[model samples]
Target: QGTRELVGKVAEALASLPPVTVYEPEYVPKPPVVDTSEPLDIQRLDDGHTWLIQGPWLQRLMANVNFDDYESRMWFDKTLRESGLYQQLEERGIEDGDTVSLDGYEFEYQY
Candidate 1:
């Protein structure tokens, strides 16, 4: 019953409205622009951490880290420890128990 009343009200409202004329401009195809910019590079942000450039690999790894879950965080840490970047950070003088940050998430480094 309410739906019928709503439909009737909508029809009445539409009937009372003035007509609108839509003007669509001519569609012109734009020339495709070639990419000539340099690719993004990774950088060391601190003694214990480096800034990860946005890429498919980084996105896939970060997608698994859930800050609210302990197990997920542990998995992320283990993954980081197993990766070549861990050795790079160590060579960069990252000490045990030092806080390491990656993509804004911070955690303690352990051997």
Candidate 2:
């Protein structure tokens, strides 16, 4: 009898509670614009070298003789020389045989 009375009280209390309100978000659509007039330029630098300069940097491609060496040495050297460390050293008056230390790595400029 006590358990039934308690259950009845709980039901009455639940029935007296106010209803909850819910909110739903609206969706907005966005479309991208693309230009199709200009075509990609594929240039042949030489018999074995070809370069494709696209609109996006990731889309750019290069086919060269000895690509492995080119990627390892030429690209690595170019990117390294263009880095902030190299620029900072240059601004600080770097000279031949000057050693530069950055982020625990050290490099000596010979020319």
Candidate 2 C-alpha lDDT tens digits along 1-111: 599999999999999999978878765332222332344333323432222223332122122112355444355345335433345445545666655432223345655
Q: Per-residue lDDT of 1-111 in model 1, one digit per residue for the tens? A: 599999999999999999989999976443222221333234555543533444444456776667797766666666655555677666767667766555566666677
Reference-based lDDT, residue 1, model 2: 56
Cα-based lDDT at residue 51, candidate 2: 27
Backbone clash tally (model 1): 0
Which window of ten consecutive residues has the lowest lDDT sum in model 1? 31-40
Superposed Cα deviation of residue 78, candidate 2 (Å): 1.0
lDDT for every model? 0.59, 0.43
Candidate 1: where are CA atoms >4 Å away? 1-42, 46-56
**Where does the lowest 10-residue lDDT sum fall in candidate 2?**
57-66
For each candidate in turn, give its C-alpha RMSD to the true structure in angstroms. 13.4, 18.4
Overall local distance difference test of candidate 2: 0.43
**Which has the greatest lDDT?**
1
